[model samples]
Target: MRKPQQLRNRELVLLIFAMALTLGAFVLVQFGAIGELDTKVLGVVGIMCVLAFALHIVLRIRASQADPFLVPVALMLTGIGTAMIYRLDLAYVAHWNVGTSNAGEHQMLYAALSIALCIGLVWSLANYRVLFKYTYIFGFLGIILLALPFIPFLNGGGNAVVWISIFGFNFQPGEIAKICLAIFFAGYLVRTRESLTSTGKRVLGFTFPRAREFGPLLVIWLISMAIIVLQRDLGTGILIFGMFVAMLYVATGKTGWVLIGVFLAGAGAVAATFVMPYVHGRFEQWLHALDDDLYNASANASFQLVNGLFGMAHGGMFGTGLGQGRPDITPVAGSDYIIPSLGEELGLVGVFAILALYLIFASRGAHVGVAGQDDFGKLLSVGLSFTIALQVFIMVGGVTRVIPLTGLTTPFLAAGGSSLLANWLIVAILLRVSDAVRRQPRAVIG
Candidate 1:
């Protein structure tokens, strides 16, 4: 095992570099320069960085060997997140008079807590196989959590009931459910892969999986439909279902399941569009953007998306520059619409850079999956990676008008505590899997 001092040098160096890059960017943008130093926020972030370094030191000292890339990756994500939040806060301050409001402070707190939780989750579990032991419980709990936002008493958010307010603090349960569902799907698919692959009947050019073999997916599809119809949260329901379908295909290696999943999803989307007013409105607005009557009458419905496109266009190649662009004019600029805000401030080049980062992260995660030693680890890594990729695609595509808007948050870059914590937890799980892969003996015969 490497000593804490040895690990501290590397981790601290990475942290310093990340912080310097983030702060330097802010200074260049001139957004974070004018605010009162907000020492309390700085103090909390400082302590978190110190603690993260300390944790890396302790972990390195204890383990005989660990993945060298894990700490640096984590630091990069945390740094990007902190910088994005700070940037958004500057806009919030200028427009909404929300200067020094506890959002940034709370985000830092969530980051620190998420880091601690990640350390604990990775350290306590001796093996990846152990997750399978509680898959059922975790799966059920995930479904329940996903449904919690629909509960009348607990539900928050007007247009979308994706949040629940607890003691005046809002939390998005769907974020956490994503991880739980990934774990469940990974474990479940691994356990059932052989049976699912063998039990299906072949017809034409495809294998039609047995109905019993399709029970879990059927249930998921039904639940997704229910969510869309009842909670009116098509984004989350689609995300969960998409993740399930992707993992199932990976586990079974059957293209039929993928086709079936797509067919079912298409049906659900059509049904929801016809029956759900919100879904109908969004679709109509998306498809009929040029219709003067619709644009004139439902302008409020189309305002944010329209403004978001305008902002992105205004960004051209080099962004208008941070604080100089009218990103704050876009509704929900700090959350669902943050990508356009980024495009407007950072320009198309900056937006492309951010997208490039996500691509790098996704590619690295896929590498981890392919390199993993076992089905469980591989499936888990792939599932997590797919979730991040899909979520980013959904949100980015929505804001850019590549697709109809789905209110999904950008992974770490979006400003929300639940999202921050959930994403960090995901990265932690990925590191754990990568560590396991790294430790595997190279010459072992299967």
Candidate 2:
């Protein structure tokens, strides 16, 4: 086997570029906000630079052969997000003057903390295969985390039961749960790939897994439905189910499992429309977004969806120029609506660029998964990468009115601590897996 380049030096070079991108973003925010550079923006850049280098240090020590582009891709997106948040913060201050929360400051702090967590994740897992040992444990923990938001005392968010509030702090455990569930899906599927791929039921030229092997799929689907039913979170539920389906297909190379999953998911959705008001309401809004009565109704209206559409339209081709667009007119512009906020400012070009970064990230992750030497590593890589893909699609699709809006944050770009930390870990895990993929050829030859 031919040896691939070590790429550690390449990663360092990219790290420099990534830091430059982030710095540039900070400067833009400063110019857009106060029309002058702030020492605080410089401070944030310094912190990001330190974190970027620290992450590079670990990559050099450990995952030297990992893709050089992953961190840089993530960094550029982070910069854009931070810049937008700062713009919104400035807008809030200028507009209301009453709400003085420095969300951009919080975002930078979260980025630092998230980087530390990502580093710890990278440092702790010298071997990705160790995760395979506790697959069931991860799955159990995932279930518990998902359920936590449903409890009365633990839940806080009014919209969906996805947040947990403790003391003075609030977080969305579903974010963390997605990561754990991906790992569990990967590890478990790796263990069972043999049976899952084997011949059993021959239905119209498709080979289905044996009846006994269907237990895992059944359980996963049930767990997904539970989240939908109990927590009223369609995005997380679909995300978890979609991750499992994608991982399962990767593991077994079987289309049957995917078909089964889709059928069940559709069946569940139909049932949900009948049983759950929330699900029905979303569907109503989605299907009748432009209907006179429905759009203007006092309750279950598509006001948020309509407003987001209008905001994007107002943004136009080149946007009103960053920090100048009225993203604040859209609800929750800092969180779920950040994309629209960005679209309003950055326009189509900026939106496409942001999406391109996501595409590159997902493709690189897919490349890593396919190149792995072991089944578990392959499944894990694919699962983690697919996790981001699913999320970006769901969030972007919802805001654009292409689909029903489910309360899901855009991975790195959206303002949410749980999302920030979780996505960073996803990047960390992929780095480790990529390193393993590169080292495998050498291990075999040696």
Candidate 3:
């Protein structure tokens, strides 16, 4: 086994590279956009650098055995994201003469808070097993969080009622719910995997769980459908349900469970297209984004989608270069359409590199799951990893028109405080699990 100090040293080395990449991107953006570096932005970058190293220190002391690359990769993505937002902020102000977006500054602050939360979680959660004891509580809390947006007074009104306001601060409860639900799913599946695996009957070479064993799947399916129907957000519904299904398959080692999940998800989505106008409009925009009338529609039309596509095309293979391209022309470029924004400036290669980072993060997460000695840790780690992977697929697929766009933010690469918090917590949990897996004594045959 590797020494903890050795693992930490490796992490420190990679962290330096990640920080360099971040700082380099910021420098390019500053020079390309404003012809001069801004001291305030540099100060923000300094703070982010300090926070990154602080997280490394915390890991060395509390989670030295954790995966070395996860934190660095996530930090790199966050840095690039902040740089892009800052670039767009400059464009918005320069071209339109609008009030400063301040998105870049806010994203930096969010990154700091997220790192602090990650540090706190790593420090306090000395053992990941304690989470298993409160599985149902997490599940119930997840449900409550999902429902909070529906309350009249507390609701943070938007086209999609998915945010809740508390003390004048608006946050998306669904982001936090994803974590709670992942824990619940992991714990519940660990307890029930035996029946879910053994009691199923074989039909045409596939084992189908009995009605009793299938109850949990049905309940989760209902909840996912409720999210789609109630919240008017397709992405979160797909995200949560897909996460549960992935975890279920991992638990049972049964492909039949996945087949069943796909069918249910397909049915729900199809029914939604007919019954929900918003859903139907999205499908129309996706299917016929170039249609003159549809493109010309003023409200909730394909304007954003078409413009994003044009911007990406304008970028071509190598890209128009950071801050040289007009990513701000697309609506909400920092949040929902950040990929396109990056695509416009960074080109296809850059997008692929970004995707590669996600792939590495997800693969490391899966590695942690496989190395885990306990069932709960394995399931939780894999579930969390799958959540991030599936989210990336959904977001990228939507932007490329492979799927209709929904309101899901790009994981660490988008400007959303709640998403940053939830994702960092996941990273903390993964780190904790990795540390625990390494600390376990290896079994040997003499």
Candidate 4:
């Protein structure tokens, strides 16, 4: 067994390396003359680094038995996000008459807050099974939170009612709701899966679930529709519904559930396209952009998509040597559209490398689910992994135009406080599950 001191040394090394990478990137951007950098910005970043390193030490001392990969992975992601946000801020300084310092400061602040929250979450929920007890309550609360942004007095943004300003700070309830709903769905499916599979009947060619078995799904569907109607956020609504369906399939290993889900999703899409003006407009823009431009004859709908594709194409194999390319040309370079910005600056190879990291992360999560001792543990791990996988697919596909554009933030990479915090919390929970699995005893045989 490795000595505790040796483990501590390794963690310290990892934390230092992470901080160095972030600071190095900031220095390179500032010195390369790609964009101007203010000393205050660097000082802010330095402070963040010191705080993160300090937090790392605290976590190591408090949770010595926690999954080793958890803190390192979190640090690496936070570092990468900071680097990218700084790069984008530099670009903003070059183009618009806006100050780039605020973006960097906000990102750094959010990263610090996210790290603190992740550590607290990991410490508080050391035992993964505790979450199972309040799954239903969490799920209901999640639904309420999801709908909170749509409340008449609280809603913000006309494009999507995803933000609610509270005491001057804007919050995205959907981000927190996603994790809570995942927990609830995992527990619900694990408990009800046997009944769902055993009670279904073979109707014609497809197996049809009993009416009672479909109650939860119907309620979920209704909730999804409510999201679409009230928030006008088709992407989030679909994401939540799809996550539930995937978890249900994993829990029961039932093809019928998947088929029903696909059917329902298809029907929902058709209904939404015909009924909701926003949905109709997006679909129309996606389908007929070459002919009639929805956002004007300038083809602005196609413009951003085209620019993203061009960025990827320009990236080719190796990127334009970070900071050499014009990533700022793509709209929303710091948020939902950050992938293409990465592609422009880091190249296709870098993009593929990031994708591989996510794949590896997801694979590890699946391993945890398979190895877990209980149904709830299995479902929770699988659900969290599936949520990350789906989010990646949706955002990447949206940027590539493999699917219609959806304003979904890239997990870990995108510059958003809510997204960063929520994803890190999800990672913390996954680590808790993984640690439990590793500590579990093997079954005895006769």
Candidate 5:
């Protein structure tokens, strides 16, 4: 194996190229959003450069054996996202005359904070395995984070119960909660995998786990129900339940578990639509988006989705060339609908390129999991990576009308502080695991 210094050197090289790409995006946003580039944005670009290199410096010291590709990929995606937000901010400023509350600026701030938090996690969490030791504690914290959105005073008092407002800043605790849950799931499964895999019955050429093993599955399902019924967020409910099922399958190596999860997920979705008016409405809007009367019923009715579709359609192959496209026409265009905004501006090629980045990032994350010597590391790596992939698929598929839309934001791209922070933390955790895997001694055939 190459020395840790070599890995760090490789990461340094990638960081340089990544920062250049980010600068190019920033430059494009400036030119497209306005007729000329601004020095202020340039300053922000310079800050990001410093921050990116500073992060690399920390990695060199803290996680020298970490995967070289992950951080660079994250930086690139974050840059692309910041550029899009900047473009929208420019349009909003010009149209509404509101020079304050710039989403792009906030995104940059979040990026810096996220990188710092990542550095902190790596610095403090010397051994990823210690997380397994405190699995229950992390699980408890995860549950509290998930429940925070429902606190009467903390609640953002919006349609979403997944957000809490602190000192005028709206935060989605679910983002962090999901990360904590992945760790807890990985650890818990490691402890219980042997019992969970005991053969119970054979049916249709498939073997199922024992009746007692169903406890965890039932608990996850119930949590998903509460998230949908009480929290009023179907997307998060799906994401949480789906993530648990994925980890369970990985732990137990049971095809039966996945099949069961698929069935439960479908049934739960149908049940939620019947029981929850908000969920039902979303499904109806998705199903009948093209119907003119429904589309025009209310100003905010189906307009967002319809507008997003029109934007993408307008974009076609090559988008209207970044800032030239009218992405601001869609509501919440900087967050949940950011991908559509990008699809509109960058065209299909840009969209494909972005997806490819996600693909590579996730692939490397999975590789880290597969290569790890310990079960906890493997489970944690796979769970974290799968969570991201599933979220992206749901977000992109929803925008494209491939699935009913969810309220989840596009990761590293959308204008959400909570997502920014949580994703960066995840990167830190994955890098730590990667380092551990690399440091592990190779098996000897002799």
Candidate 6:
């Protein structure tokens, strides 16, 4: 194993570069939005930099052998998101006359809190494997979290019942539920891999698991459908199901599991279009976005989608430059539509850059999982990484019209406190796993 000090030094160098990238972005936003560089931008950028360095320091003391790229990649994505939101804030105040919108400032604060949480988790969690002990407990807790938004008193949000008010702050419990569920799925799959992989029905070169062993898959599918139907949230439902299926495939090394999951998911989606007006409307808007009647409709129209398309089209290949594009014209531009907002300003090149960061992050995580010495660690790491990858695909694909828009927040890049916190915590978990993987001794064969 390499020396911990050497790894920490490597991480420190990358951290400095990531901070510089963030600082440069803030500078660009300031100059482009206001036509002059203002020192006020430094307030948020400076605080974020301080918090980021503080996290690096914690990693130095606690997890020196952790993967260096994860932190830097996450920070870069979050920085780009904050810069874009800041640009939108300036536009909102100047042209839209929405003076009360301080979303950019609030996002900085949320990023700080998220980083602090990451520091605490990395500092306190001595072993990622300890979580395996509470596998069933986490599973139960995930169910409760997912159900919280259904409670009449706790449930609060428009269009989707995925938010709950806690201490006067609105949060999406589904975001937290995904983590708990990932933990649960990883641990559960570790315990059941043997049976899941046992020989069963062989159909056209694919060996499917027996009906007796299919309870878990069926239950998860039902839960996902319930989310889409009861909560009107297709993204989270699909996210949870996809994470489990990916982890299951990793555990069993079986391609049939993925096929079964896709078939179920496709069937559920088709059924949803007929059973739920919300799902049908989204499909309608997606398929006929350019049609005048649907596009111009007053209620549940494709206006937002059309505007987002136009915004990205206006940017073309290079982009309109940071803060110069009118990204705020789309509804919920800071959250679900943040990708298009970024696409419009950063252009195809910038969007590809952002996506490449996410790809690197996921690749690093998958590497950590493969290097893990224990099955539990392997499953957990892979499950978490798949969660992030699946989310980016759903959001970016929706914005580009490759799929129906499911209103999922872009991980680490969207303006949502719950999402930021959940994703940063995932980074913390991966860091711990990577550190453990590096610290383990290789076998010595006599």
The backbone clash count of each candidate, in order, is 1, 0, 0, 2, 1, 0
Candidate 3 Cα errors over 4 Å, as ranges: 443-446
Provide the lowest-lDDT 10-residue window in model 5.
437-446
Put down candidate 3 lDDT per residue, 1-446, tens digits, no spaces: 78889889998998999999988899999898888988888888888888889989999888888889899999999999989998999999998888777888888899989988998999999999999999999999999999999999999999888998999988999999999999999999998888889767889998888888888999999999889998998999999999999999999999889989999999998999999999999899889999998888987689999999999999888899988999999989999899999999999999999999999999999888887778999999999999999999999998899998888999999998999999999999999999998888871101
For residues 1-446, write the lDDT of model 5, one tens digit per residue: 77889888888898899899998888888787777888888788678778778878887888888898898999999999988998898888887677665788899989988988888888888999989988999999999999997788999987768889999999999999999899899999999998999986887977877779988998999998888888888888999999999999988889888888898899998888898878887887889988888788763367889999999999999999878989988988999999999999899999999999999999999999888779999999999999999999999999988899988988899999899999999999999999888888881111
Q: What order do candidates take by TM-score, descending?
A: 3, 6, 5, 2, 4, 1
| List of clashing residue pairs for candidate 5 | 319-347
Which run of 10 residues does model 4 get worst, by summed lDDT?
291-300
Give the Cα error of residue 196 in candidate 5, in Å. Answer: 0.6
Which of candidates 3 and 4 reaches a greater TM-score?
A: 3
Better of 2 and 5 by lDDT: 5
Query: What order do you get sorting by lDDT, best first?
Result: 3, 6, 5, 2, 4, 1
**Alpha-carbon deviation at 381 in model 5, angstroms:** 0.7
Error of 6 at 62 (Å): 0.9
Which residue pairs overlap in candidate 6's backbone?
none
Write candidate 1's Cα lDDT for 123-152 as tens digits. 776676788788988899898898888777
Question: Between 2 and 3, whose lDDT is larger?
Answer: 3
Q: Please provide TM-scores, in order, for all candidate models, with all chains considered together.
A: 0.88, 0.94, 0.98, 0.89, 0.97, 0.97
User: What is residue 292's positional error in candidate 5, in angstroms?
Assistant: 0.9
Which stretch of 10 consecutive residues in model 2 shows the poorest summed lDDT?
Answer: 1-10
The parts of candidate 5 lying over 4 Å away from their true place are 97-101, 443-446
lDDT of 5: 0.88
Candidate 2: stretches off by over 4 Å: 1-6, 442-446
